[model samples]
Target: MIQNRSLARRGAAVVAAGAAALVLAACGGDGDSDSSAGHGGHKATASASASSSASASASQGQRNAADVAFAQGMIPHHRQAVEMAGLASGRAQSAEVSKLAADIRKAQDPEIKTLSGWLTSWGEDVPAKGAMDHSAHDMGGMMTDGEMTELENASGKAFDTAFMKLMIKHHEGAVEMAKTEQADGAYGPATRMAGEIITSQSAEIEQMNKLLGKD
Candidate 1:
């Protein structure tokens, strides 16, 4: 009877050991499942971040019709101003007038290049250099061919006065156009440029008016 009881006790111990091993195996399986879930969540978060980055990039690149119009119109306008400014080298009487012409040329030349680059990036055609003759006739503050020719023939004080008058008018038109761009354009850089144009050219207008004794 003692031997029988010893065998029964040994059997009970074996069953208890089996139960503990099963519990440990179930806990290990749960840990593995949790680890796999955590890894999957990380991958999903990474994918979402990549998608958000792409969306932001696309937003930055987007353009509207008004942006295209602003670039196209401003390029030719800047080019004409540069051309007029180029004629001031030896003809202008006042040092201030000559300096102003130089500034206009310096500022507008690079702006023309930037405008052209924007057009090219947008897959739009840049205005040909010779197109200004036809287009300028209708644009506000643009000088007619006869007026340009008359200024070209003028000298000394006459040239300075004519240059300032024409430039003031030209700057006014640019300011108006820039205002339109600021109001209607969707491109961030282009709108910012428009604001700059308005500020700088308005100041120049005031300067020119004072120079003309009209302020």
Candidate 2:
């Protein structure tokens, strides 16, 4: 009977040890699973954060509707200014008027190309030459067809006076548009250009006023 009890005790100890090992194995498996799940969750969160940052960066760089309008509207405006400046080569009586016109052409021509490039990159349509003719009067300080015709027909001192007056009006319009861009645009380069336009054109306006003998 004692021998039987000893054998039975040994069998019970073996079973108990086996059960403890199984429980330890199960707990180890659970820990490994939790660790793997934690690692996976961290990777997923990191990926999501990276995606969000990329999206924000793209959004910040993207042009908005106001930027498109600024570029579109300014292109034709610059074109008209350039055309008017071209007429001053031999027709302007005052050397100052001629110099001003040349400067306008020089400054605005490159701007036109730059604006065109922006529109092209953004998949926006650029304004065709003379596109502003029909709607010029509606824009701020843009000359009517009649006024442009008159300027084109004038010469000598008459040409100089007309050029200064009309150019003052044109510069004013450009300044206003620039102000709107500064106020409403989201593009960094465009808004910076707008600020530059406001400063330069405002100075030009003052200069024209002095030339025209206006306070």
Candidate 3:
């Protein structure tokens, strides 16, 4: 009887030891699975962040190209118009014509300054101080030195008539140039200015035509 009881107690202790070992093995497997899951989550987050940063960089590069072209083209165009406006101030005879020239000079000079600043900020060159090749015939409403001299020498109604005629043609040419930029230019600000020029100059051209009829 005593031997049988000792045997039963030893059997119970062996079973308990086996159960404990099984429990420890299960805990170790669960810990490994959790660690692997954490590593995978970290990798996914890193990949997402890298993709987002690349997209932002590409968008900014596109905007930069547009801004640069707008500043470069518009500066030269505005400069020529301002030169023409200056001629009008001294040569125009009618009070209305003189007022129009003054307004054009005032509006365009400040715009020139603004465009110059944009070019500087973009690290682009401002248009140099020379006449651009603006004509296929060398007479696309562009006043040569001789033509300007002729206008400058005239007085009274003749001056007014000549100035209005020249300016009407000049504005037409500017409108054409602005249309080109609006169609093909890349930057938002530049394209917008080009549209404005087309609208305003077209209206002025009509006014100048009326002035022509008066004479």
Best by TM-score: 1
lDDT of 2 by residue, 95-146 (tens): 9899999999998999999899989989989888766655656887777888
How well is each residue in 108-136 modelled by candidate 1, as lDDT tens digits? Answer: 88888988998899899998886866666
lDDT, candidate 3, 1-215, per-residue tens: 99999999999999999999999999998999998999989999999999999777554433455456556655665676677667765566788888777777887788788778767766788877674655422533566666667777876678878777877877776677677666776656667777887898888788888878843
User: What count of clashes does model 3 give?
Assistant: 0
Model 2 alpha-carbon drift over 4 Å, by segment? 1-60
- How many Å off is the CA of 84 in candidate 3? 2.5
Error of 3 at 75 (Å): 3.0
TM-score of 2: 0.74
Q: Please say which candidate is ahead in TM-score: 1 or 2.
A: 1
| RMSD of each candidate relative to the true structure | 2.7, 3.8, 5.3
* Candidates, ranked, TM-score: 1, 2, 3
Clashes in predicted model 1: 0
- Scanning candidate 2 in windows of ten residues, the lowest lDDT window is 128-137
State the displacement of the C-alpha of residue 195, model 2, in Å, after optimal TM-score superposition: 0.8
TM-score of each: 0.85, 0.74, 0.64
Q: Rate the local accuracy (lDDT) of all candidates.
A: 0.89, 0.89, 0.72
